[model samples]
Target: MLYKFFVKYLKPYKKIVFIAPIFMLTEVIVDLFQPFLIQQIIDKGLGAGNINYVIRIGFFMCILSLIGILAGLSTIYLSSKISQNFGGYLREDTFKKIMSLSFKNLDHQSPSNLIIRLTNDVTQVQNLILMSFRILVRAPLLLVGSFFMAFFTAKSLSPIIVILVIVITVVLYIIVHKSTPFFTNSQKALDRLNTVLNENFTGIRAVKAFVREDYEINKFDKKNENLYSSSTKASLATALIMPFLMLCVNFGIVASLYFGGQFVIGGTLAVGQIVAFINYLLQILVSLLISGMLLMNVSRAIVSVKRIIEIHDMQPDITYKTETVDNIKGDVTFDHVYFKYSDNDEYILKDINFDAKAGETVGIIGLTGSGKSTLADLIPRLYDTTKGKVLIDNKDVKEYSEKSLRSQISIVLQKAILFAGKLNTNIRYGNQSASDIEVEEAAETAQAKEFIDKFPEKYEKFISQKGSNLSGGQRQRVSIARGLVGEPKILILDDSTSALDAKSEALVKEALANEHKDTTTFIIAQKISSIKTADKILVIDAGKLISIGTHEELLKSSELYKEIYESQLGKEA
Candidate 1:
């Protein structure tokens, strides 16, 4: 199975692989010729006292050595080229599969697990392919070739060679079988450590604010200790292979010398033939030892390959429908939609219905865990609704191509993620074709221009990873600007203004009113003031739409709205 996988990827670089074996063949022939030459130097040159003949053979040996060196260099160069292209192709394929995954599929996988599959796991498979070309092919060919040469040259000593090969193969099988589980577990333990460290680094501010640094450190220490222990065990197991193989090799040599010496004394074998027979025995044992090492690597590679393949084979739950939508308007309606996370038994969003026409603004307000975000995610098909239809411009979202439907809507999530890039690059992420002037205009509208202009590089200033250098409000404003850059027909701002102060929030609101008058916007927020001026407010409670109307209408009729308003505004009435 592993060999077939390499052949498939390497098929494209067939010319390289084709050239590689010819090099190996030359190297092997040179290797085989060396032992015979040693016998010739002993029997014909040194024993007979012929200087010119010895000189000629010695010169030919030099030529053979040069040929071997050139062949080895060419083999390594070609193998490296194949390995690099093969590794790149596999990593690219895995990444594309990850990009195609839906939120449902992503939720089921850990970030650390995914990272391992991408980096460590892919590297393991890559190393195997590279080594297979350099060492795997060479070792097996050398072993079999040496065994056949040993028998052809001297049949009497062949039984000893066969016995030693059998013993070494059996010993290697036992060691690898016992060590396989340790190698597999080591990969899992490393993933655990990665997960803990990733979470800690991401939440360092929270940990420090809560004065839980020691606690977090201890938690990390525990995970680190587990990784350390697993690695020690795996290393110890792998360490056993070399020493055991070396011992077996020594025993094979002693056995060959003891038995072959008798043939020499009886005149049944020439002194040179006995030496040649001993050299063959050593060659056979060396090949077996090399085969053992390759098997160990192949075992680990199998586990790593399976890890990578797991992600490759995953079928996304929310794949694109075959149908396509050429034109999609701003009309959106949720009809009796119900949803729950795959791991959860209870629905996060129960049966719900609502609509927002073109050029209308809808405000969703509720207490925490009211399923507000889940409701908003339905329109974009981020997660499939369990029980109902979410329509876009009167057609079910599933009926349209996912790309076409998503392209028309822009969502500024509550988290407000930003990548490491220039300020303009981040803003223009929603539409890469957006000009610098367009990006600056969106930034001004989001109330981000004043702060952005203070930077020395202005629009070209680098935003650190996830915008860590920027304040929370600044990050939120930049995220809002990105969404606005798309000029989306439908925009969903999920508490996007929560990080800004009241004054900046008002300025952003005014900008939205002036710039996006024709667009349908859904504003989700906790502060009553944020949605007080909205055209329609939907009061949601536990995944259900409790009431929908203007702000004043809801304040008069909805008790939930009244409670939320009084809590935030501190007004009893």
Candidate 2:
């Protein structure tokens, strides 16, 4: 699975991946030739007392060293380019997949988990690719080349090289195997820490209000401790590989010197030959040590690959057909709709049935946890019903392309989310092609123009992240203007006016009725006064539709309606 994913994203950079290894091999070959050249300069030039031969061979060695340096540099350059590009592609595609997911799909995963996968996990895989093209390919080839050359140079001492190689390989394998699970655990710990941090940062105001600083600190400490322990375990395991490898290499070096000294005294090997053999032994050991370190990265990358692939494997719960539909007239119907977050969970909305004509205003009022927002979410197919169907303009919403269905509907969430950009850009999010006049008119209708005009830069004024620079009512009004700018046929406001004063709310409502009379609107509110003037009001209780009627009719007929009206209106009622 990991290989297939790499092949898909890295296909465009195949030439670089291929070319990088060729340069690495060139560098390795050049390194291997150095010991042999030194052997010739020592035996043929120094021992034979030939000054010209030593100088000639020494000059050639310098040229080869330069060539090796060039090859190494080229290898590093190409490997980094390929790896960075592959990481960029992988991160972008994973984020796009997350954006395409349905609300139900997002419910199963946390945003922090996705953020870690896209950034940290992608980086792990990228480092592996970079190492593969550099040390990973070079180390094994150098080890093998040194072994063969050691045998060819002095067959008698080759057995020592063979034994130490086998021992180091076995020990490194065990260390890597024992550490793989710890690395996986470490990554999970990091995810948990990120989740906790994200929540704390987003809700810092609430934490301060509730005086829960110590509680939050304790929570973060727990996650931090888990991450610290897991990382220490993985790091300590990997740290052992180098010291053990060096111990074995040092023993091999001592043994080679002892044996090679005997062979040199016996006249079977010359002084130069012994020197060359020890050099080859060191080369083999060094390559193995480098390879052992790279294996740790490879193990971590394998875990990261699995994490990333898990997201790509998910099939979104909501999918649209290829068929396109014309602009809908905002006529929405929910037929026997039932919704549960998951199969094992209890239903949030049960057997819900309702209809709204084009240009009609429907008010939904219910207590918290009564699935008011869930029913509003159904019209845009944010989540598909567990049973029955949602229809827009007399056709099943699932039959229309997602673009076609979403283009006609605009929803202003209870929490008005705004990005960091100019006021114009935030408002233009609803309709990028809207004219300046259209933008002004929408803001005016949303009752936001007055406050916006107070700013020095007016429409071009910059907004902070989540609109932190604006007051709560100002943010909500701007969000409403954004929804209105698109001129969507259906506009759903889920408690969007709760922050506004009665006068502002009334003015906003009056503007909507006068300017957007052809557009259907669903206003979900907790206050009776907010929706009392609606053409039709639907009352929900614990996920069931308790009553559907005009405000006067519901007040007269429904007990729940009268109780809520009296709670808020009292003697005025």
Candidate 3:
């Protein structure tokens, strides 16, 4: 999976990945020459009692050191370039993919996990690229080069080299296999920790209101402990690699000295030969240790690659067309609509049929979880109906392009979400090209201008994250203003006035009726007063639309409607 992902994403930087290794090989070659040069200095210069020869060879070694330094620097530069570009491109693609996914697809994916993949996971892959250009490329080259050079130079020492290599190889394979699964578990632990944090911050207000600080702390500590344990276990598993390899390296050193000393005493090897043999042995063992570290990194990188692959393979559930429908007038119709979250789930909306003409106020009133919001959601195609059609402008909603359909319909969701920006910027979000006058008009229409004008900065006042700086009603009004700024043909207010006082709600309703008379509207509300004056009111019970008529007519005909009215209006009805 890592190989495939790298090939697909790093195609642009493959040349750099390839070239960096060439420089690494150059460094390795230069390193391999060092032991031989030392051997030459000891045998020819020192043994012959020639100071000039010592000076000449020592200077030549310095020149080789310079070349090696240059090669190492070049490899570092190229590696950094490849890794950063590779990571940058992958992050960009992941963000774009997240944006393109349908709401249904997003429901299954955790935001915390997605964030980890974009940041920590991609960073791990970037590290793999860096290691590839550095130790990954150089280690094997130095290991092989030193071993063969030692073999050809001292055939008698071959058994020592072969045995040490075999022992280290077996040890590395076992350690890496044991540690690979731990890396995957640790990544999951990180996701869980981030999830706890996200929930805490987003609902910090609720936590404070209920005084559940200790409960939240306990939750965080539990997740944090799991993350700690998982990370420590992974670290322990890989930590074994370094010591085991070092022990094997020491064993090789002992074998080299014992065997080579005997050979020198027997006159079969010179002192320089034994010394050079030891040098080569050290190089081989050191390279093996570096190779072990690289394998540990590969294990972690493989886990991240698998995670990223999961996201890359996801296809959006709702497909949209690029072809726009002409004159989208927002004439919405639900024709025998049936909807369920999935095939196995019960229908949230069942056998529903209704129509709202191009310029009328349609009110949907129901109890909690009675499908008022879900039914309203169909008008903008947030979720497609499972067994029927939702039509816009008399055309199936799916027939219009996403931009053409959604851009014409504005929905201020039940939550009244506001972003961290100036008031003007928030309002202009619906239509970026809306002029200052248009923005002010929209705010006035939503009754948001009253409070906004009180801010010292007025429209330029900086709103905090999620509008935490504002009151609930203020946030709701800001959201309504944002929706109205685009002058959408269809506007759906899903319990948007629930936060406002009765007077404030009345003012907003009066402004909407006067300013947006030609806009088709849907009001999904729990309070009867909110929708009492709507042109047509639809009464819903369970998942079915039970009655549809004017307010006075429904009070007379529907027991359910009359029950709701009597319960709320309290005999004043």
Candidate 4:
């Protein structure tokens, strides 16, 4: 897994990776000489009563230590520089993949999971790269060098070093194997916690209104606690391996002292040779312990790399790479369009056919769940039709690039969404280069200028998050003004005026009619009065177009339309 991830992301930094190993090897060489210098001082100077030999070896040892420190610093700097750059590239690529993913692909992953992959998982891989250079490369070098140095002095101490290495390796492998699955589970728990917390914060007003604060709080705490427990369990299991390996190291050193002491007292081993063997044995033991620690860090990093790979391997369902079209006409047609969200379920839109010319106002009225909004959504390709063609300007909508198709259409939803910015900035969102006069004109046409002018700063006043500080009708008007600023050829109002009073609704409607006389408008509304004056009205019922005519024609012929008209107008048809 580590090799695959490196091939994908780290291949570009081949120079840095290649140079880092040279510095690491030099550092290891410097470290291997320290113990040999100590032996020389002990045997030649202390044993023979020669202070000159001790001083020379001691001074040379200090010089080697300084070179080792410099090499270690160079190794760390190069390794970290490569890791940081690689992490940045990984993060950007992951986020770009998420952005290109369609709704179908995105449904399988949560926002928190994506965030974890981008942040926590990326950090894990970065640390691994740094550690592989700093410690992993040194462990094997020290182990092999120490063994060779010890063999030249006395081969009897070699058995103890070999056994200690085997024991530490087995223990480290067991800990890594057992803890990997638990760490994966801990990451998933964190995703669930993020989802619950996001939902609660977004619906905080509704929760408080219904007096369910305690319920929401309890639910969030449960998920949060689950995450904490999983993390603790994973951490405890991984932490136990280090101390256990340290114990093995300590035992090997003690065993070497008892066995090597006999060889020193006998005529077989000299004092210098015994001293050198002890130093080599300690070096080998220390290297084994360091290898165990490096293994643990690398094991955890492998889990994160696999998690990030899941996202990178995903293919977006919607792929459109055609050239952008700048010239667009607003003629739209739906030919026998049938659509369903699932293969097993009934169609959301069935055998629908309609045409809206370049300049017309088409009103769509329907009962709840009648697929009114779904029909309008087809024009912008929000969801693909199960079986039909939606055409614009005599060309299939799918043939156009996504940018060009969306640029020609604008929609204002029932629930207004406003970002935290000045009122002018919100109104000018559809067209950023719109001047102050054009912004004020659009707001006035939407009947938003009245409430907006009441504020001291007027257009410069700041809106809160999602426009929570504004009333429902006020937010609706601002959203309308935003859509209108673009001057789109195809404008869709999906229940855009439900919150307005009779007077303000009529005023906004009149403004739209006069200002945008040539733009094609598709209005999805619940109120009969909102659609009565349109050039034509479409009555949809249960995913089918039940009736299509003007309001008066529908009142005279269609019973369902007449019924809705009477219910709202409060009179007999």
Structural similarity to truth (TM-score) of each candidate: 0.96, 0.98, 0.97, 0.92
Best by TM-score: 2
Q: Which ten residues in a row have the lowest lDDT in candidate 2?
A: 564-573
Give per-residue CA lDDT, model 3, range 214-284, as digits (tens).
99999999999998998898899888988887787788788888988898899887777777888899999
lDDT of 1 at 456: 94
lDDT per prediction? 0.85, 0.92, 0.89, 0.85
> In angstroms, how far off is 169's CA in candidate 4?
1.3
**What is the TM-score of candidate 4?**
0.92
Q: Whole-model lDDT for model 2 versus the true structure?
A: 0.92
Residue range 1-573, candidate 4, lDDT tens digits? 557778778789898888898998999888878877777788788989999999998899989999999999999999999889888998898899888887667877877778878998889888988888888888899889988888877787778777877777787778778877778778789888988887888888899999999998899899989999988888888779767866876786677777877877775766777777777877887787777667766767888888888888888766665878755668878899998876888998899888888878899999999999988888877777789999888888888888887777888999999999999999998788889999998999899999999999999999999999999999999999999887888899999999998899999999999998877899999988888898888899999988888988998988999889878876222
After superposition, the stretches of candidate 2 with alpha carbons farther than 4 Å from their true spots are 323-325, 571-573
Sorted on TM-score, highest at the top, how do the candidates line up?
Answer: 2, 3, 1, 4
Segments of candidate 3 deviating more than 4 angstroms: 323-325, 570-573
Q: Candidate 1 or 2, higher TM-score? A: 2
Task: Report model 2's TM-score to 2 decimal places.
Answer: 0.98
Per-residue lDDT tens digits for candidate 1, residues 310-426, read: 887789888677756556668888888888886456888888888889878899999899988888888788989999899888888888787687778899998989999898999
